[model samples]
Target: MSENRKSKVGSSAAVGNVGKKARNFKPTMKKLISYLSDYKLSLVIVLIFAVVSTIFSIVGPKILGHATTKLFKGVMAKISGTGNIDFNYIGKIILLLVVLYVISALFGYIQGWIMSGISMKVTYKFRKDISEKINRMPLGYFDRTNHGEVLSRVTNDVDTLSQTLNQSLGQIITSVTMVIGVLIMMISISWQMTLVALCVIPVSMGLITVIVKYSQKYFKQQQDYLGHLNGHVEEMYGGHIVMKAFNGEEKSVHKFNKMNGQLFGSAWKSQFLSGIMMPMINFVGNLGYVGICILGGWLAVKRTIEVGDIQAFIQYVRSFTQPISQIANISNILQQTAASAERIFEFLEEEEEIPEVSNPVKLQNVNGSVEFKNVHFGYNTDKIIINDFSASIKPGQRIAIVGPTGAGKTTIIKLLMRFYDINDGSILIDGHDIRDFTRGDLRSIFGMVLQDTWLYNGSIKENIRYGRLDATDEEVVQAAKAAHVDGFVRTLPAGYNMILNEEASNVSQGQKQLLTIARAILANPKILILDEATSSVDTRTELKIQKAMDNLMKDRTSFIIAHRLSTIRDADLILVMDHGDIVEQGNHEELLKKNGIYANLYNSQFEVA
Candidate 1:
């Protein structure tokens, strides 16, 4: 038990040490306010309701004080034998107080109803905007960012913003109004006592400000650790099977526990510091309450203040501290909201893909011809990958690209598909620059089967139909039969309707590859890109898939990237790539006689087997 306690204490200190001074937040806040500008009218209505409700509520204590004065005077008069009790006046005052309280509650409810809708609508629109922004972002952006970080921004940060708006937006306005109103009422009763009560404001604010100064860093650290923890967990879960197979469970868990501990420490400190605000504010309030009551009693005894006035003054003193405390709490919440808002804005402001042609040209009766004219390109211009690379292919050509790892094998396909634009030079399809076509139109002409198989949680048939949404059942089955996906799919418990599960773990990797092939075959694109498409399957399954691919490649431009030389032996033209440059280009028979890099690569593969 002692060790556990010590560990927790140490964990908190380590996490708390991540504190760094925050930079200027004015620009981020100004931009976020700009997003809220569209809801100006709705906010105006909310403001009106909040002000009216607060005004009505704040006026209540003063009117109730009138009833207290009336009751006190009546009792005193009866005891002094000066006059009779005026119960009628006292009853009227109490009735009006009840009516005022009810109206205040009604308006408060209406304000909350309207504000809830506005807050939710704003968050919904922000979420929608982020979703569209994600699509507009280049693939390179995703490559550089973690999937969980992006997801957390969408779910976590957006939720934090929404929650802050809902809980604190109205509190800020109402608390300010109540504080000003209470001060006025207190002065009207007894300015001397009001002066004493006013002392709580500065004391509470000072104490809270000092605590907040230290707490803000922890809050920011909490958010960062939360994001990192989420990303790490997502990665570990994604590769859980591989981790366990290699006996990496202990390492993964240790890393997770470390991150989780940091998150816990920061989260607790932020909460603990913020939580102290209420109790401390309440303590100072009680001190003021005691001081004011003592001063009011002496003033009443000296006949400088009436019994009713003293009662109203005491009520005013209590009400004053409540709003001050609420405002302090709201200030802390604003800091956290600002942190979440900054993260969200950063994602929304990321650079988008380059604009497409204003007046794009259409490919009419495309002959599947492609050409790379002195294309100079790189993921980053400082480090050029494909330099002065040039290639030309006729329609219906079976071109295989062979290269060692990191030789820009996949970069070539990405460029042709326009997933990433070339930095310099040009790529033309049928003599027309590829840039002259919309990305949607350019990508529409090609079918890609990558090494990774992506199947969402759905029925087997639904996954295939994703290729061509409008494809008929007959067409889906035909494509499946052609790719041999129907063979194993039919053996499942529910056959074509079998659920693939979320990770698509219900089927083997080889089967997943076959399903993707079926999807591509169903789409029947004008060009085909097979990137190690048969790497996951067995020799027998590879033969079946290869036969299907051969039939599908007829009369279509096909680019194959493979390390298996046997698979590409029949390729009409083989381009041997090393360090992003093609060193040799010829058919199997011709390259063999040359005994160049292509021959060496082919021989190495056979030797490995």
Candidate 2:
């Protein structure tokens, strides 16, 4: 397979396996816990409330058992004609139980409210950090990584952490508290019955362990395939037009069906295992119940334990088993949480771009005198694409770079903008190293119009104003008129106010190019870079764009990367590149007279035209 296809396939495979079991679960959990550190006081309060609520609930059955015992004795006394039943005592116990339950419910509500707030705050912080990290990240990261993969971390992974914190965190505390409280209550009633109940726990745990071990892989697979499926769908939707034009519907459908089938299998298996856990645990609890009942009955016959005690012990057993089951389920959920947290933390911890200097050079005025001295660069350092390239341009010069594909033409523009830094040597603007300025300050001085135009879903005026956010409506309209966009825009129903769709398909290619040109015009930067800016337009549109560009470049240092030699015949200087080196450099007329590399390239284009 071609390297590009291999990379795409590899990326797809990597996306599917991204949610597999975390490599370092303990560390990931630790990192996740650190996010909650800021809310430690609130979490402590929530913990206290959770414990108190559980204690209240746990003590209820035991307290109610006392009433059962009291009523039983009263009935026995009444039947024997010894004494009257204690109605007032029973009434007091019932009222006390009601009060305890109400208090428990209130505490539970408070804790839930606090926990939810903490979870939301943490989620907000997570998303905020991711957004900031995206800005600081290098462009190479995006080039190598899939867009959907990054999006998954922002959306899916963060959501998983959020939901788990909101729901499972409270559940874990409550379940642990319930289990401990219930066990104590059971033992207080009768140790023999408690021992019998405890016997079944090992069996239940053994079954739970086995089920979790087997289901863990399926759960991982399910999550993995879910990401893969989502990424595939997004990719197909984004490129649906091209795919359809190339008649790739069958292939797309086949891939979708294959992935969907794997997802279905994994989902079904994971859910089935998770579902059976409750039933299996419940069955074990029932077996323990039978054993406890027999032991309690024997003890009661010997008057060693009361009937009421037996009733409470059974309730305790039910309570004990329930929390155990909950804890088991929660364990699986925690695994998924760890995986999600790991992905998010991994992204946040990625290497950012080189830090800006503590004290940066502030330019009083940008004269647009750009010089590249002994420049060496490569996307990969070991295989340099630009080998010791050097160039110099005076202020307000229109320098055109003409090169064959892969001759590092676009790389020069990127280096000038500092999208990627040069490996060696200095890129200076007005004799100050570009690295001396902050990335934002350095980038702000340059305006770019590329072959591929980017405009978001917004009105034409809003899109134009994106170049200079503070630009007035009048300024925007002037820019549009300068770029020859006003005439075409006015013919539309909503004119400048017409909202572009998500893909901006409402406008033709030429119109899109025009809008981008207008955006550049509004920026009014010191230096302008045009990469095949008029490539998409027709003869008439190209002429109009050329006129606008000529006016735009009149007082600015401009760099143009063009394939058509005829268009740049009037350039101040043309640097003809072959391979990675600038083989010839001169004005078009001078190079044509030299009959060198530039001459041959110009002659070919002229003949083709």
Candidate 3:
């Protein structure tokens, strides 16, 4: 497999390695907060409302306890027949309790609305920044990285950040507020009871710490194996045809079963461990409750505290424990958020393409003359591929580059397009360094058609018009006819209007090549490049394309990278390359007469045929 494909497979297997802990939690969170700085005012409002809402909720049970005490006293008085029960006083307490809860609900709803908007706005900004960053990133980065890895940052990581912001942010504020407020209420009622409730926390926390520590590794394993399983399945499905041809179904199934069994084992263990936490903590809390109730009854018998105080303390105890659990859960969620935020920040901070010159030269008319003067380059600086290469082509000349595989043929094209910058020397066009002109202007002078044809999901006419967006329907058809695509397109239903599927698999490979050729023809560029462009089509169709290309090459500088020597026999100049240097250069017949590398390469093709 190619290095790029290997990187993709490795990336897929490691994708689920996320959702664990962040390497730099504090720094990641600090940077994430900087993004929210833009919405400081809104966040403040949310904070204030959240605190207010939680306070109201915290006070509700205490107020209701007063009503409970009033009712109890009235029953005692009526049974003793002492002065008649005060029904009106008890009714007033109940009414006050109802109003407090209703207002609490209203504030909670308003805060939730504002929090949701803030999270969505932050999500939009994250996506927009990532989108723009992708454009500015150097092509070298993509050459070494997996496309799926980049996509995961754009989709999965951003989504994780968004959900945490929308849901967990508010929960964090409320949970903390509840814990503090309920603790105060419990203390105010009875310090003794508050102390009893506080005892449950240490035990609960100890068990929780142990559970999380053990289950964390299982959770990570589950996610890791889940990624592996998904990657294996996707690879198998994508290459099912190749697998069947090789009759490797048994191997594929066995691999899948192995991964599936591992995923099941880890998933079950993680879930079971996580599932036991709540009941375990609740059992600990129940023991604390038992002690508090016994102490409360003794205190009431001695008349040291009101019945209402005991009831309110119990409510505060329940409220306190719940938020502690919520806070613990939110802590885990925050860790995941930090991990996601770190990935996004790392992408945004990556080295961008070399900055464009402030005053780049603009060419009004390109003459198509090009020269490579001692150009030195390497995908890696340590490993020079194209070393001190030099070549010159005049205006309107047909130049053919022929070499064995891995002879730096495609690297030459990539250098010309400025997809990568050369480490040494310079490439000149029209007597000016190519870098003097803006990359956009430099690339605009040339039209390229490569072996791997690219077509989007669009009607055939639209695909052709992509070469020249301003071209009218008549121009599109003329270009299509020139490339011999109009005939086959007309035979299909809907003709040029037919919508291509996402993969553009609806058309044959040769037809796809023809459409791309039609696109390049419509560009009407001053310089043209064809890299094994006719390899997909049969000889009969190739002849027609060659004729059309010949007409299009008139008065235009063209470069052809071909393996088949017979195809470029009529070139104005043929350059034979090997190991990143030109071994020979001349017309086809002149190179053949030399009986050197070019002659040997030409003879071998015919021998293979």
Query: Which ten residues in a row are the worst by lDDT in model 1?
Result: 1-10
Each prediction's TM-score against the native? 0.95, 0.96, 0.92
Query: What order do candidates take by lDDT, descending?
Result: 2, 1, 3
Supply candidate 1's per-residue lDDT for 205. Answer: 86
lDDT of each: 0.85, 0.88, 0.85
lDDT of 2 by residue, 1-609 (tens): 111111333235564454355777799889988888999999999999999999999999998889998999999999999987899999999999999999999999999999999999999999999999999998878776766678878888889889998998999999999999999888888988888999998999999899987777776676667767777787888779899999999999998898888889988988899989999999999999899999999999999989889888888888999999999888878877877788799999999999999999899899999998989987778888788888999999999999777787888888889988889999999999999999999999999998888999999999999999999999999999999999999999999999999889999988999999999999998999999888888888888888989999998999998888878988998998876788889998899899997888777876854
Q: Is candidate 1 or candidate 3 better by TM-score?
A: 1
Which candidate do you rate higher for TM-score, 1 or 2?
Answer: 2
Error of 3 at 128 (Å): 2.0
Cα lDDT of model 1 by residue, 46-147, tens digit: 888888998888888778777887888888899999987798998898889889889989989998998899889989998999999998998877765667
Write down the RMSD of all candidates, one decimal each.
Answer: 5.6, 2.2, 2.9
Off by over 4 Å in 1: 1-18
Prediction 2 TM-score vs. true: 0.96
Error of 2 at 364 (Å): 1.4
